[model samples]
Structures are given as C-alpha cells and as structure tokens.
Target: MAIVLFALPLAVVVQRLYHDETVTGLERDATRIAAVVPDDLIQRPRPLKRPAGLPSRLTVGVYRVDGRRVTGQGPGRSALAVRGRDGRVHDGAEHGRLAVAAPVPSDEGVAAIVRVSAPYDPTGDRIQRALLAMAGLALAAVACASLLARYLARRLARPLERLTAAAQRLGAGNFSVRAPRSGVREADEAGIALEATARRLGTILERERAFSADVSHQLRTPLTGLLLGLESALERPGADLSAAIGTALDRGHRLQVIIDELLDLARDTEPARRHLDVPAELEEITLRWHGPLAAQGRRLVLDIQHPLPAVSTSPAALSQIMDVLLGNALQHGRGEVTVQAADVGGGIAIDVGDQGPGIAEDAPDIFARRSAHPSAPRGTGRDAGQAGTRTAAAAGHGIGLALARSLAEAEGGRLILRSSGPTVFTLFLPDTSMAS
Candidate 1:
C-alpha cells in the first residue's frame, strides 16, 4: 500500500516536470526567432534562412496578425497568432499539437507572432522510464522483506507447534511422549517444563496402578481362605452344620470389612469428622473382632477409661483404623491382644497392642508395601489363614496401616507405632464433644 501511494503520485509529478521543461525550451526558441525576424518580411510574403542544423521536430511559424503563415514552413503552421505584451510566452495550440506563441514587437507595438511546438511524446517517454525503475526497486525491497519475515515466523512457530502436539498426546494418556527442544530460548524453556510435567504425571499414574493391584491381592487372599475353611468344615462327616455355617458367616463379615477399608482408602475426599463417643465405638469394634481372634487362640481385652472423652472423628474412619491396628496385632502377635482407650489432655487415645514378639530388629521398614522377609511380620500383614476376622489383611504392611494412618490424619487424628516391645499402635484424636 505504501509503495503504491508514493510511486503513483511521484510518477505524475515527474511527468509534469519534464513536460514543463520542454515547454520552457520551446518558449526560449520562440523568443529568439522573433528577435531575428525583419520587420519588412512580417507584413508580406517572405522567408528567412532556415538554420543548417535545425531540429527536425521543432516547428516554427511566423504569422501575420490575420493568422496567415508567411515566414517559415512547419508542421501545423495554420495556428492563429496570439498577441502578448512584453516578452511573455502565451501558451496555445498549433492545430492539435502543443505550442508556445509570443508577439513579435514593432515600433507600432505588436505586428506579428512567432510560434514554436514539438510532439509531447518524448517527454512522456522519459517520465515513464524513470517511474518504471522506481517501481522495480520498490517491489524487490518488498519481496526481500516478506521472505525474511516468513523465515523468522517459522523459527518461532515450529517449537510451539511441537509443544501443542505433545500436549494433545499427553492428554490422551500417552505420558511417555515428550516435546523436543528448539534452539530458541523461550521455546526450549517451555519444552523443558512440559517434559517435567509429563514425567510427574506418568509417575503418579504408575503408583496408582500399583496401589490398585495391591488392594486386589489383599482382598482376594482372605476370601479364598474363607472359602477353603468353610469347604473343609462342611466336608467332615458328623460336623455340626450350624457351627460350620456360623464360622463361614463370620469369615464373610471379615472379608466385607477388608473391602470397606479399601473403599474408604480409594475415596478422593477427606474423611467426615464429627463428635463421636470414642469408647463406645472402640468397644463395639473390639467385640466385632473378638470372635476371630478367639478362634485363633488369642484373647482380646477391652480396657476403657470410664467416661472417656469424645473425640472428633468419623466413626467409619476410626473403626477402620482400629481394624487395621487389631489386624496387625493378631497376625504376628500372641497371647492377649488389648484395645485400651484413655483420655489424654484435649484428646482421646486408643492403643491396640499385642503381647506377641513384636516387630523384630531384623524386620526393618516394617511399614513398607511388602515385607522385607517372607516370614517377617509387618504391620497389617496379609495372612488371613490364621483368623478370618477383622485381622484378615496380611504382610504387605503397605496397604492397611498406611490407609489407616491416612484416614486418621484426614479426620484430624494421628496414629503411630508407640512401642515395639508390646507392638503398640496408638491413635490420638482431638476431643470436640464440647465444641460449638
């Protein structure tokens, strides 16, 4: 647009200037012709000596006042004489061609006129040539600029295009995909950041998959054992049918508890918290697990501090935590397993401990996902063969105890391994019964 604006008007001005200069030269030639012409020849038919090198295109005419050409013969000599005062050149047309006419002065004032003319084409040719040159230069410059701009834009846009494609793949669950870095500083930085995010997302998804596998394994083991135990008890001749069925039902209830705990762990939301009677809830849970532990020859002692302080926690979350602790106690624990409740300052404490050998020095990282040793008893062991009750989840210490601790913390409580000798796991929750 700018090229057009500047070039077109400039072409017009150059053409006009060239035409005006031609007119100026014609006027000067006309004045000289008038000065040399004799007065006697002006009123009568006469001719002057035409110069030897006279321009072929220049047309000069000396005309009488009545408009008759008398002096020199030229192209379009039939133009009328224009009378002008002083040396002023009067612009007029000679036939159809452009010409300059001026008065030839005599003692009596104006008597005849001298005119000069040339075809206007040569001046137009010069101007057109000059304008064409300017236009060519301008177009070349614009072409160069456009090429440079395209190159620079591709440099910047290529990296962004790769990033966009990688993002799409990642959103489609292809976390292994990565964006390659462009040499441009800004694009390289973005690629680096995007690659990091993909790695983090892949790691998180891997852990979740592993967690799911662990949960499935933990749940299926006990259910299998319970089925086996039920089949064995029912197969025996003269077995008490009611007792065997009752035991199978108890095992089914324990299996259900394991599922419930896993479900709670799977929930993305925090556990619900409210004022709960800690002692009453613990008492109920102990009784629920007492049957399976007794079947395994372990005594359960519920030692509750009278008038226990009410703790702020969800009953479901607290019950699951206790189940985890009690399950841990029953697997590797021996003798009497105790569910002891006490009121500490501003909180309630429940200690589920066992008189078993406890975590051995050899059982390091007892809370890891899998036990270090095959026979090593870790918190929340996965063996359900001992008792198909609340203590069902076995060895991986990874799922149950971790899930229990997570639930406790979510409900504004804490669960910790308080002692190794008695293998005591203590749960502390803030008392909120008096809170408004």
Candidate 2:
C-alpha cells in the first residue's frame, strides 16, 4: 500500500516529463528550419507551405504577427503561437501540437515572422500506451496483493482457531484439550501458555478429587463405629452400657480428629508463608508430649545442635507434625526416641528416629487410604492398617504417621522414611528452604 501510494504520482510526473521532452524536441526542430530558410521565401508570391506526403495525423499551420492565419497545409488550423520568439510552446486547445516562430532576417529590416506548427499526436499516443501498460500492471499488483493477504491471514488464523476450539473444549470439562503449536513466535508462545495452564488445572482437579475420596474413606470407619456403639448402649443396660458409651465417645473424638486433619490439608494446599523458630517449635511440642513418653518408659533425647536457624513455616502445621512424630515414637518405640535438628549445607535437617520394629519393605505402598496390612495387627479403626507405622504396635488409633506426613508437607517440608532396621525407624524433615 505504501509503495503504491508513493509510486502513482511519480509515474504520472515521469510520463508528463517524457511528453514535454518530445514536444520540446519537435519545436526546436521547427525553429531551426525557419531560421535557415531564405528570407525571399517569406516575400514570395505564395508563402512557403508544408512538405508533401506528411502523415494525416500531423497538422501544420502558420500565423501572422497579429494572429491572422496564413498559408499552410494539413487542416490549416489557427496558429498555436502569434508573435512568440523561436521557442517551444504547447497548444491549449489541441494539446498535442508544438508551435514555433522565428524572425525573417533581411538587409533592410526584419521581414515577417516565420511561425510553424507541428502535430504532437505521438506524445498523446505514447502517453496512452504508457497509461494502458500502467493499468495492466496495477491490476496484476492488486491480484497478487489479494492472494498474499488471504494466504497470510489464513496461515495466521489457523492456529488461533484451533486454540479457541481447544479452550472451548476445556471449558466443557475436557481437561486434556490442548492447542496446536504453529505460526510465529508470539503464536507459539500463546499456545505453550495455554498448554501449561491446562496441565496445571488438570493436576489441581485430580488432587482435589483424590483428597475428597481419601477424606470420605477415612471418616466412614469412625462414623460407623460411633453409630454402632451408640445403638448398642441405647439397647442394653448394664456395666457394658458404660463401656459402650465410652467407646462411642472415643469414636466421636477420632472422627473429630480426622475432620480437623482434612481441614488442615485443605488449608495447606493454598499458597501462604510464615516465619518460625525451628528449635523453639520442636521444644514446645516435645514438652507437650513428655508425659506420654515417660509413661511408656521410653527415653526422649533432644540432640538439637545449638543456635538452630529460624525458619519460615506455619506454626500450627509444624506443631501438628512434631506431635504426630512424637506420638508415634512414644507408642511404638521400646527404648529411646531421638529428636535431632542441625544445620545442613542447603537447609536445616530434622530427624525423628525411633527404636521400634522398623518399617516393612512395602511401607510406601501400604501408606494409602483403604490399603491394609493383613499380617500386622489391626486397630479398632477400619483403615488403621494403612497408616504409616513401623509395625502395628501403637497404643492408639493408627493415623500418627499419615498425620505426620501431611503436617510436614503442609509446612513446606516432607516426612520421608530415611531408613528402617530391625529395631529402628527414622524420618527426616528438610527445612522450608527446600520448599520451592
């Protein structure tokens, strides 16, 4: 478009220059001829006439000084110039004729002015041809531009169209829908961004679904137990009634704990940050559980390296994690349960090691909702077998290890089983620096 805008006027000006040059050359020729012609010729009985056998398209004429027509041939049109000097001039009416005049030099004085005119029809014909060629070229240019514009628009639109369709599919619950990659850098980048968003959304939905399912399964056992115990106590009357009521109360408490844990899980899934003192938090939880450890006749060892660094974490989450670990140790550990924290190269490292029968080789697989270990003793709860424990020697419900792992993850740390021996189970928690 820019090229056409600038080139059109330039082409017109060039054509006009070419036509003017042709007219000027013809006028110069006529002037020269008049200058060299004999002065007697002008005073003769008849004025000098145009040459014979001239092309019919060529019109010639002569005019007196006062604009009177003189003798000539070929249409004998009125002169284009009156008393003008020997120079090139254009006819206003004819447009294609060049007019010239020269003084007839004589010994006595200046005789009549010799004016001549010649047709400039060739200039018009050349301009017409040029205009026709220009029109043809312009048509070709328009055709090519249309084809190119359509091709480019289609090429650009195809990928975006696919992306729009994929987005619609995703909106309709097809989480797997993704855009096709094509086009230039910007288009490709947009496609990649859409793909990444889809993947993240799919992952989030899947995790939520799994968490909902796990929570439902975990709650069902306690709920069933509570219902049965309450029914039994209501139907019977004796010392057994009190025991049944107590059991019902215990089941209700366990149900409450499970609900709280689920709530914690949901909250931890959201993005947040907090600052904490690792040693102080650990000391507080351990002190809370010290009585339980003493009653179990197990020694509690806090081999914390001094000047432990402050960490960023959720205080409630960190406390819950430590409680779960200490509870597991006190319930199962036969001798000593050691809690240790120290500065590792990248971050702080905390370990909870228990002198209990170590975890089985299939511990990881067993630590899922609804999974059970038939060889190990079952707790009163239905899904207790699947809880993360070295063995089924715990004194209470079997959710300590699962809760510990959840709480650790909530605080931007992980509870990993470092090693399992015949009488030892060790868990390592990396500090918040490793969260991201």
Candidate 3:
C-alpha cells in the first residue's frame, strides 16, 4: 500500500513532464524555421511556403508588425505566436489558439511575429494516450503489490495460526502440540518459547499425577485399619466399654471424613466440566442443607439473581467447594448465612457469606502443613500432648480452603475471600473466562 501510494502520483508527474518536453521541442523547431526566412518576406507578406522537409503535421502562420494576421493554415484559422529570446521558446494561448510566438529578424524597422498553431485535439489525444499508459502501469503495479501483500500476510500469519492451534490443544488438556518452526527470527523464538512451556507443563502434570497416586497408595492401609477398628469397637460386649467405643468411633469417623476429603482432593486434579444453571444448583444445595441449618438455629437466606448464565464447571468440584464454605460457616457462625448467585459478564458467579467469626488475619498461613492458628479450638486431654501427632494425622484436612481454590482453578475458575468482617466470611467463586 505504501509503495502504490507513491508510485501512482510519480508516474502521473513523469507522464506530464514527457508531454511538456515533446510540445516544447516541436515549438522550438518551428521557431528556428521562421528565423531563417529572408527579411524581404516580412515587409511584403506572401505565401512563401517552405518545401516538405519539415513535418507535414506542422502548421505555420506569419503576422505583420502591427499584429495583423498574414498567413494562416491548419486545423484552425488562428495561429499561436512563438516568442524567441536567447534561442528559448515562450508559449502563449489566446482566442481559441494555443500559441508559441517567436520574433523574426528583419532589416526594416518593423519586426515580424511568426506564429504556429495545431488543433488542440491532437495534443489532447497525446495526453490521453499518456494517461492510458500510466493507468496500465498503475494497474500492473497494483497487481504485483496485491500479490506481494498476500504472500507477506500468509508468511506472517501461518506461524501465529499454528500457535493458536497449539494453545487450543493445551486448553483441551492435550499438551503435546508443538508449534512448527518457520519464517523469521521472531517466529522461531515464539515457537521455541511455546515448546518449552509445553514441556514444563507436561512434566509438572506428570509429577502431580504421580504424587496423587502415591499418596492414595500410602494411606490405604492406615485408612482400612482405622475403619476396621471402629467397626470392632461398635460391636463390643460391655455397656461402659461400648460408650467409650462409641466416642472413639466418633473420632474415628471424623478422621475417616478427613481422609475421604483428602482422597477427593487428590483425585480432583482433573475435573469433568459441564454447564450448570447457577440459581438451580444453589437452590438444590440450600434445600439439602436447610434441615441442618434450622437444627443449628441459623437462618439461611438465598439472595440469588435470576437468569444467570450456566457456568462451565465440574459438579462434584463445585459441590465440594460449597460444602467447605457452608461447613466452615456452620462450625463457626452464630447468625445468618446467605448464598447468592449472579451473572458476571462471560459466566456465572456464586458467593456464600456467613455471619461467622471471619477469617483471621493470619488465615493464609493455615494452608501450610502443620501451621496452626491461635483461633482454632484446642483439643481435650484425650487429644492433648498429641498436637504434633494430630497435626501430622490431620495434615490433609485443614486444606479445605486450599482444596476449594485448587478445584476451582482446575475448572478455570477462582475461589476468593471477597470480604471479611468481624463476624462475616464471604467466599466468592468466579469463572476464569468471565474475568478475562
């Protein structure tokens, strides 16, 4: 486009210059012929016509000293005057005549004006031909430029297109699409970066998968023994022992719940995503938990916005996140718990707010293994002196918030602590695509 823009005007100017030079040359030859004519011819005006050595197309006219026409011949009766000064041609146009006037030297005090005229039609024709030639050249230049632009666009776009495809594949959990290297240095650099990212991601995913499997394997034996022991205790033969056994069984059950949560978290690295209506899902969860909330003397409020878009997420993962949020509320809250859902641009968003003792300022540290917050209730004597042991045993359970965040991220979403007051904790889940 840049080249065409300059070339077009340049061609037009060149064409005009060539035509002007041609017309000036023709006028100069006519002036020279008029100069050689004898002085006697100027005083007595007659048809002293020259032979055919000059161009037959040329037209000539002679005028007396008083500007009266002497001889006129050609397409038009009127002729243009040619003025000569230092052997240079000067042109003038008047009275339907395009003129080049020159002075003819004479012994008589009166000098003669030699004028030449050609019909404007021939000059117009030459200009039209010149324009036509320029148009053709412009057309040819445009064709070549178009081809070049297309070739350049293709060369630049091909690598970017491959990168797009590779990104889509990565999004689909296929991390094996390597971009083909081609084109310039910048393109090669981008390809190399993509390949490196894929390799690192593949390695990280493989490690996570292996770690999950190993954790499941290592915990199987202890989990089984704990379950069996609780069952045997429940079947004990004495009333007092049975009561003790029941208390032990309750503790064992809590441990079992913790282990189950861990297994779910480990397996939740990859989640099945599906579109779910936000209002409907929230209603169902609220219904299921209504009895429990009422039993605890807490009011559950639904402040859902209708017509929310369906969110792409894993149902199980979403449920687990909600469970952790609600469970934390129930365990710690003293008043109302509110659940709300709404549309936030590209996807649906859900927030669960509880009138509980809100997250401690140091809550983030709880995500680390064995890091205990001062706010957590201390265990009784039976579990005392067991802080280190219990910390190790319950290591996986305290990561509920962390698990919620991880599960949300796996489904291309985020779990955030929106706001925390003295007695409020709000958990907000927003789809990643919506934020983007």
| Global lDDT of each candidate | 0.71, 0.58, 0.59
Better of 1 and 3 by lDDT: 1
lDDT of 2 by residue, 137-201 (tens): 88888899999999989989998888888888888878887677785677788878888888878
Ranking by TM-score: 2, 1, 3
Off by over 4 Å in 2: 45-57, 74-79, 83-91, 95-122, 172-180, 213-275, 287-303, 323-338, 361-364, 368-414, 419-436
Alpha carbon lDDT at 27, candidate 3: 75
Candidate 2 Cα RMSD after full superposition onto the native fold (Å): 6.5
User: Per-residue CA lDDT of candidate 3, range 35-85, in tens?
Assistant: 676677655767857545766665676665455666655332333332342
| lDDT top scorer | 1
Model 2: colliding residue pairs: none
lDDT (Cα, 0-100) at 322 in candidate 1: 83
For every model in order, what is the number of clashing pairs? 6, 0, 8
Model 3 — which ten-residue stretch has the worst lDDT? 384-393
Per-residue accuracy of model 1 over 70-109 as CA lDDT, tens digit each? 6776543344463444445686555556688777878887
